[model samples]
Target: MSAPTPSARVTLAELAAEAGVSLSTISKVLNGRTDVSRTTRAKVEVLLDEHGYQRRGTRTPKSRLLELVFHELESAWALEIIRGVENVASENGLSVVLTESGTRHAPGPEWVEGVIARQPAGVVLVFADLPQDCRRQLESRSIPFAIIDPAGDPAPDVPSVGSANWAGGMMATRHLIDLGHTRIAAITGPADVMCSLARIDGYRTALNAAGLPFDRQLIRYGNFHVDGGRDNALELLRQPNRPTAIFAGSDIQALGVLDAARQLGISVPGDLSIVGYDDLQVARWSSPALTTVHQPLIEMAEEAARMVLMLREGEEPNNLRLDLATSLVVRQSTGPAPDAVRPLAAVG
Candidate 1:
């Protein structure tokens, strides 16, 4: 008997015909579209596996293009993260697509839908909250996705990468405490964000550990922007029982706090000490360099991108909760408490 020749590449039409389904139904099942029954999807998936068919444009049977979604392109923080993602994707010979969530006023929902239509290998969400419906759609389709600094409710089992925000918060507050500052205030990011909440918990933990009472009056809410930081700082400074030190959740907010102090004619470390999180380039170049807890943003981005690629290749990534450590960098912005008052008695 003659040896049988292998069939050519399996087409969508062939898979549908073999499965005794319509082409459109097969397409929906293969691409993870809605309105498909679980039984039908399983059957189609099995057929694809049996035939050794490859997705279009993929070099290897498992290779794929990944998409990165960001809300704003102008933010240096976001840009650095994107660079990290690109570096990892390039090194692995994978393709990447970039999409912006549109402007602050008019966030474009269409872009997300468009990415889903294109069916990239996976997705990486940066600093933006994704809708529940979108998440559900992706889950139904079996598209792998990961989030970096996610601000929304994350799905269980989905991988995520972020710095140790709570630890960073604790480090920042502890740095202030070590500088002999007992009356320390905190400026936090949006209340809904997990990072903000984690940082707040850290701040409270540090204060409690030092035998200090957790004073709610010393905490202020900000939008993680410079203007918000400035406003919060001004409000804190106007209070009768003002804090001797301030910890801003982000570098931008720290800058705002510094500006507010300058406007009020208060000398940094002479009368007020300030600490910031996220040691972006601006933190070091400020008039008095910011003492901050540095979160490895680039490394975080790289890890997130790498994980997405691994998922695309059908590899189970060993790392699930990749928690990066944070360290405090002392600088001119912090010093011993001002000579204006005596230290409070330790609680314990």
Candidate 2:
């Protein structure tokens, strides 16, 4: 028999006949059974794709596991996110399955295959956009997913959780401005990322609102790391008309700014002030505790997990994009700008 039309609900017998396989073999592939040979599975999957096949009555299938995928696990913030998801999982009597897959943008093909095989209740991805094909595969299988997007960029149609990066940036800068700092410099993440751009824009807006002139030379875009902060701070501090305060993209980067100030014999909060973002744990433990913008990472993760679970329950979210509010945490790292400048530290 010829393959059924795309609009028609194709049956296992039709798919098996089209693939020249037994009806049982078709069932195995549909169920993600690994007993089938690789070649046979590929052939079956291609035909299933062409036919828009999906298992009947399996949507919102009963499951007790939630999956959380991360592009990389090296950052300390990962723990906060894990704790958030674990909190939700515990409340719902579900288990969390953590996986490190793909890059910052999208997971690898193998990840989708593994996820399809596992058939999770729902999935939460951190900093990774789901590709269209992978999204289709998951949707066809009736798997719900959400993104915890700290980068502030996600697919328009996807449900995502993020913090108010622009407000965070503005608050950080405003705190410095409130400290009587006129010549303030900002060190943020890479130029291409939306979060970085939003934060910097907030900084500029704050400066303009406070009647402070915006200086292009005072702005530096670097990776969200300690080294990026230190290197950029070094250059900024060396200039004759150096800023008395600096706002960093991340708490880790703030540590580097502290390092750079120490190297230049500049006393933090005495001669210079500093502000950091994310308010990570390290911010509290720094030599001089960081004054920072709290991004509410744990809360954001918790919201994303809740969204995923809601989707699994066949509930539609009122909003596709949820941005949590960011607040400023004042600590010892910032103080009023010095009234009189100290002589420049000697640089070898």
For each candidate, give its TM-score against the true structure. 0.78, 0.92
Cα lDDT, model 1, residue 11:
82
Worst 10 residues of 1 by lDDT: 339-348
Model 2: lDDT of residue 245: 97
lDDT for model 2 comes to 0.88
**Residue 338's C-alpha lDDT in candidate 1?**
86
Q: Candidate 1 — which residues are off by over 4 angstroms? A: 1-21, 24-64, 102-109, 116-119, 127-133, 136-142, 150-153, 341-348
Q: What is the C-alpha lDDT of each candidate?
A: 0.77, 0.88
* Candidate 1 per-residue lDDT over residues 1-348, each given as its tens digit: 121234566688888899999999977765656588878866876676566555544323453677888778777587778888888888877688888886532236576556656777788877444454455555444567777763344544557787788898898998888888899999998887778889999999999999998999999877988998999998888676778999998889999999988877778978899998889889899989999988887888898888877776678899765777888989889999986733333221
- Model 1: what TM-score? 0.78
Residues 134-230 of candidate 2: C-alpha lDDT, one tens digit per residue: 7767766778899999885887888999989999989999988888999999999999999999999999999999998999999999999999999
- Model 2, which residues run further than 4 Å from truth? 1-22, 47-56, 59-62
